[model samples]
Target chain A: MSHEELDQLRAKLDDKNMELLKLLNERGNLVKKIGEVKSKAGTKRFDPVRERKMLDLIAEENEGPFETTTLQHLFKQVFKASLELMGEDEQKTLLV
Target chain B: MSHEELDQLRAKLDDKNMELLKLLNERGNLVKKIGEVKSKAGTKRFDPVRERKMLDLIAEENEGPFETTTLQHLFKQVFKASLELMGEDEQKTLLV
Candidate 1:
């Protein structure tokens, strides 16, 4: 491919990457809000039933170019991490 | 209080703490299993609606000296960490 074409493709890739980052950041903020509510309510930090439900929801919701299974696995991890950022008690409980 | 009585109380406390640890570990193992299933299934993790449901369940079930809200917050944190141990993709997605 021509150098100009290559450069244009690279720019497009960069833009998509940025979009992903922005979406992730938005998710993080929402999760953080959850954590705050949880903490203030003096509640326990983990809920497995909910986590399982999430997977089911994604399976239901995905209109996939990617495999359904792939999306489920990927989002499972995403939700997990978002939980980490959101909950301090979870961090302590796991470590202990 | 006598020294011997104090020592006995200390041992009781230790025993209770150990029991709590054991229960937490058992929960951890179960969550890890959930993680594995989610990964294989290609599912998303984290369900706020489910989390709310859990708190409601706890409230309904508790015969409490401690408040229902307190238990909910604490368990929420626990579930979050279990997710971290289980899912790799989530870790990457969050960091980026």
Candidate 2:
């Protein structure tokens, strides 16, 4: 690819990154809301059953150069991060 | 909140998860394209300057219950996953 072509590709990648960031934050917001409900209901913070279902759904939707295993692992990290954010928000609420 | 209210929140979270999944796969596709360009041009796979700039940009855009530090850490994981996918794709090409 020419230099211009390469730069354009990088720009596209940057746009994708920003989109992912926004989506992740949206997910984080939902996680916080769920955390509040969980706290109120005395439910566990981590739900393995739901996590497994999520992984299954992601694998079904994956049409990728990325392997299913890789997608699973990446999404597990995303899930973990969201959970951490939820915990942090919960702590903050407790402190207030 | 009532059980119905909690269930509604969980359903919303499930929708967010699907949206994030689609965005992540889109990112993975872009990463593959960028990886191809990097391989052809003999450029480094990892770019720390770009990574740092990305972090800074994300922090600036962040209006969050999640802290800047949390966003940075989460994004780092996403970046790492993208790099891993790139590397995997490169290796597959080499093997072919």
Candidate 3:
């Protein structure tokens, strides 16, 4: 393959990265909204049962060049970040 | 707000998570293809310059409910996973 082919592939990879970034942010926003609702209802922010269910669903639906374990691990990072983001939003609401 | 509202939000979050999962797998496939090309051309798999550029672009584009730092951290996890995945592909190729 030519050098040009490699460049094209890299460009596509970069585009995919940006798409993933956008979805991450979208997920963050939804998590923040859920956090607000939970706070109002006096429910705990971290529901282990719900988290497990989500992870299980991910494992089931994963059709991957990535291993199921690998995808789960990466997703756990996103899940953790969303939890932290919820904490940040809760704090912001407290200050407001 | 009713319990139904919270359920709706959680459903949306789940949808987003699945979408992210699909995208991640799609990215994994692309990375695998790129790995094959790199192997063919006898080029190094890990390009720090390219990785740095992608991170910089992500940082620039972040309009986050999650902080930029948080998103960057998450993306870095993904980038690292992709690199490791490429390594795995290279090994498989070698075994063939």
Best-fitting candidate, scored by DockQ: 3
Tens-digit lDDT string for candidate 1 (B35-84): 44555566555657755655565566554333445445555555565555
Query: Per model, how much of the real contact set is kept?
Result: 0.00, 0.59, 0.85
State the TM-score, rounded to 2 decimals, of chain A in model 2: 0.93
Q: What ranges in model 1 sit over 4 Å off? A: A1-96, B1-3, B88-96
Q: Which stretches of candidate 2 lie over 4 Å from their true place?
A: none
lDDT of 2 by residue, B1-96 (tens): 457887897888778777877777887788888888888888888999989988998888877766788778877877887898888887888899
Predicted candidate 1 versus true structure: per-residue lDDT over A33-82, tens digit per residue? 45555565665545677567666755665443333465455555556665
Interface RMSD of each: 20.2, 1.7, 0.9
Candidate 3's docking class is: high
What are the DockQ scores of the candidates, in order?
A: 0.02, 0.63, 0.86
DockQ of 3: 0.86
Deviation in Å, model 3, residue A13 alpha carbon: 1.0
Q: Residue B28, candidate 2: how far off, in angstroms?
A: 1.1
Which DockQ-derived CAPRI band holds candidate 1? incorrect
Better of 1 and 3 by TM-score: 3
Scored against the native two-chain complex, candidate 1 gets a DockQ of: 0.02
Q: If ranked by TM-score, best first, what sequence of candidates would result?
A: 3, 2, 1
lDDT tens readout by residue for model 2, A24-46: 78777888888888888888889
Worst 10 residues of 1 chain A by lDDT: A13-22
Candidates in descending DockQ order: 3, 2, 1
